[model samples]
Target: MIFEDMDRIVFAGDSVTDMGSAQPVGEGLFENLGTGYVRIIDNLLAACYPERKIRVTNSGISGNTSRDLLARFQRDVVDLKPDWVSICIGINDVWRQFDSPAIPDEQVMPEEYEQNVEQMILQVKGKVKGIFLLSPYYMEPNREDAMRSRMDEYVAVCARLAQKHGCIFVDFQQMYEDYCKIRHSTFIAWDRVHPNRVGATLMARAFLEKCEFDYNHGNGEVH
Candidate 1:
């Protein structure tokens, strides 16, 4: 309910947000929104708030780090002139460090990651109605796990930036932490990064909770 009628929201980040969405920008009809939380949110908005007529756009790209997002922020998000924007990046920033240790350039260090995200927030802070700063997560439940621990640092960065910029913070890492306790992360994502439908649904629910969506609204009435 935070969004008003005809509000345009753009979801920007990496493959986690991308899934299989159309390149450059994805919106309107068919699978252009991809098969991720963005699509589910689009569906829920239409189903629960038929009168709002909110528009959701996907600006995520596969294999992108915060650096990549910052590079395209102006073109993919700012130029689109969205009323709201959600950014969920940084996973590849840490993943590259572990997966390809030899490539220093591919790995975006924490300081740079923070800077990139902050630049992005600054780009649209006053222009957009609001911003969603979603934390990058690793599905591993163990706090001591190397990747999970490193991911927590990035989550902390997101939290800090959200507070500094007065943006709405959606802690996807914490959301996954609680859900992973109930069911193994493997049940949600085999690779613990790219989530299947079940994981995507959980993500969509988490996002909607922050937006004050009414799950039971219009249940007995037809659209």
Candidate 2:
């Protein structure tokens, strides 16, 4: 429903999305799109809606902040001419605070986070059919306390930006937190941020609920 037309879909973010996907820039097959949630999404679509030739691409890079994603958005995302783009970021925005304490918050303040996302959204608005804004998150009762508060502001920014732009908002943070209540966070990702296959499956399932594609392919009835 988000992207009305069956056009190219691009997934952009950090290692969570990267998941060591093939790098289309260097070789072929379109960044492999990895075996992450993005790939899970593509796989389900291919299996069920075989007629929908929607090419899925992943431009996620490990250890990348919003700045890094924004810098290459033009080349990796825009150049693909995607009909829809899903972005999950902000972990690095907080991680840097721990790795480099001297770094000022002003550099990655919530306002700055909002600005970075807004710019990316505005740039891709007209060309793309829809945008999916995914919130960056951390594990509940994280071992790192400072990292928790720092990422909250970024998450708030994501929520606000998604609302402001009328885009689909997927709160991976809340989703994973709830998942932890039923199952160990490690059931998904050992670190709780990067996902294992089970975690990736959860994400794919969540997306499928939102995606108005198919029930079992040939049935042609919305699930």
Candidate 3:
């Protein structure tokens, strides 16, 4: 029922989305979306509702920022003509500043990040059945000053875009922070940018929580 028999799901974003697929650029069918959130969603759905037969694709590229996403939106995302699309970006918009000194923070300011996300949303509006937004996150179980200050702006822009465009929003920032209380940020992320398998699984699960599955209508419980 969710697919009307042939629904296609596509994920668009950065390295977190790009777990470890063959084409790091996210190409082909099975290997297209890498093995991150997209593949996880595929496995869960296949297990929960085998009859639904949802098709998933990943177009995530490693080391990408919102700006980079916007540049490849047409080729990597829109052209796929997916039934559902989820956008997860903006981390690099903040992380690069900490890792790469030559890169200026202004290049990915909250304002600019907002504009890029807005543009991508506009491109996918009406073209896909649903659009999901995932906020960029940083975990400081210790609540480090630098991490909080930088991620604050990036998270805000993601929230603003989700509100303005009426897209399903996943708070990776909040989720990571919550998880940090139980485990060190380094355990989930090495340099605090790229997520290890555990972190990626966490993100994938969070995204599915926001999906409106048709099977939920009978239980009156959100899917």
Candidate 4:
């Protein structure tokens, strides 16, 4: 696995990452990690690499855009001092532009979104061992859809920054697009944004793949 023993990984994003995680910080026992992909990643890490003793933290906040995430980056991410950081934001940035067209201030344009994410990466890239840039996705499979098209723009920005900064780019938008081909977007999320358990698992699988997680390691062994 890419993560070293006792590596502390912090996941920062919006509601998709939050998914009801404990306030301020989410970690430790009793499901404080929430029921999202973050918790799934933690569970799999423990089950597959019992000796690694990886520490996982969820710093996601609901309804947060890249702007909001940047505002709290220092307190939620930097001060926490994580070894690995996974950022999944920008959904609300695109959503707000379409959902509330009248409110210009509420909308975070593509240029600002790109800058906000880049600034966050610049702030933490040197401090953390590595960073994972998970693109903000709109679940609609139709590329022609206005929201999905706009979301693709943000996804491109994430890819560009990930490459420039040497961060791992997890193309979540493409992941959902592939899944939506077999199953309708509504099947995973009615709004095609906040995923249910199944969609969350898909995300977890994708993340673990990038980490080179070995599923067969402890498959037949009983702890």
Candidate 5:
């Protein structure tokens, strides 16, 4: 596994990462990690690698853009001193351009979004064991669609940063695009943003794949 025993992973992002996770920081007991992929990852880690006591924390806030996350990155993410930091922002940065077009200042342009994400990465690069950069995705499979096309630009930015920083990159946009090829976007997310349980599971699986998670690690062992 990419993560060592007792390593702590903090997931920081927007609503998709939030999904009812505790305010500020969420971890330990109950649904503090929210009902999203963060929780799923925690569940699977504990289930399959029972001996590895990896800590999972969620610092996601709904309706936040990259700009917002950057503002609180230090307090919410850095101060915690997690072994691994997973950033899943940029969705709202693109969403505002379409949903609230009238509020020009509210929108986080691609350039600004890239700067914000890069700054966050720089803050934790040498301080952590590893980082996970999860791209912001629009569920629309049609590449030509205005929103999806705009979103692709952000994904490219994430890919670029992840490579430059030597971070583990999870291309969620491409993952959903592949899934949408066989199943409609509505099957997972109706608005094509907030994912249902199935979509969250798919995301968890994709993330674990990058982490070298062994689903069969506990196989043939008596519980």
Candidate 6:
């Protein structure tokens, strides 16, 4: 119950966070929240804490990097005046380095990525009650994998910033790494990026854990 009753949380990130969420801003009824972890989070909050009535907004955009998110941070995040903001970017920032190695301009280096994320934290930390920094992940299980290894660097950056800013940090890379021990990455995502429903649920669970979500507590009863 880190979040107070009626507190609004805005989730900002790339396609993993977007997952086909409504355009511009995703909130309200129907499938506006998309089918990703964001939606799963909304469902869990409603089911587990109906009385809290938290407002969840999705501000994720497909193929966006840290640079892109920072560009729209004001309009998409700050303007919303949310009580909490959860950022889950950096995947494409690392992906572009591999998928489009030839396009040097398309890639965001680690230094710049760190700066962008840090800048975001600085901008919103004072405006919100709490901030959640979700590390970007590469679903590959092997630590020796080039992409996975490089992604680890970004994950460390997020962890470092989270600690410095006193924000809640969710290590999604580690989460997937642990899950891969029991189930292969392909079982959840074919490309190891965009997750299917199963993978999304795993992410939702991890996020809820950080929020101190109680699945068994409901209607004045703790199951």
| Winning model by lDDT | 5
lDDT score, residue 161, model 1?
A: 96
Task: Count steric clashes of candidate 3.
Answer: 2
Lowest summed lDDT over 10 consecutive residues: which window, candidate 2?
23-32
Instruction: List model 1 lDDT by residue over 69-95, tens digit each.
Output: 999999999999999999999999999
Off by over 4 Å in 6: 219-223
The per-residue C-alpha lDDT of model 3 at residue 6 equals: 72
Q: Candidate 4, which ten residues in sequence have the lowest lDDT sum? A: 214-223
What is each predicted model's overall lDDT from 0 to 1? 0.94, 0.76, 0.77, 0.93, 0.95, 0.94
Candidate 4: where are CA atoms >4 Å away?
218-223
Work out the TM-score per prediction: 0.97, 0.86, 0.87, 0.97, 0.98, 0.97
- Ten contiguous residues with the weakest lDDT in model 1: 214-223
| lDDT (10s digit) by residue, model 3, range 75-149 | 888888888888999888887777786868535877788889999999989888888898888776444578677
| Clash totals in order | 0, 1, 2, 0, 0, 0
lDDT of 5 by residue, 51-114 (tens): 8889999999999999999999999999999999999999999999999999989899989998
Q: Write the per-residue lDDT of candidate 4 for residues 36-59, one digit (tens) a residue.
A: 999999999988888788999999
* lDDT (Cα, 0-100) at 148 in candidate 2: 70
RMSD of 5: 1.1
- Candidate 3, residue 111: Cα displacement in angstroms equals 1.4
Model 6 compared with the native: what TM-score?
Answer: 0.97
Pick by TM-score: which candidate is best?
5
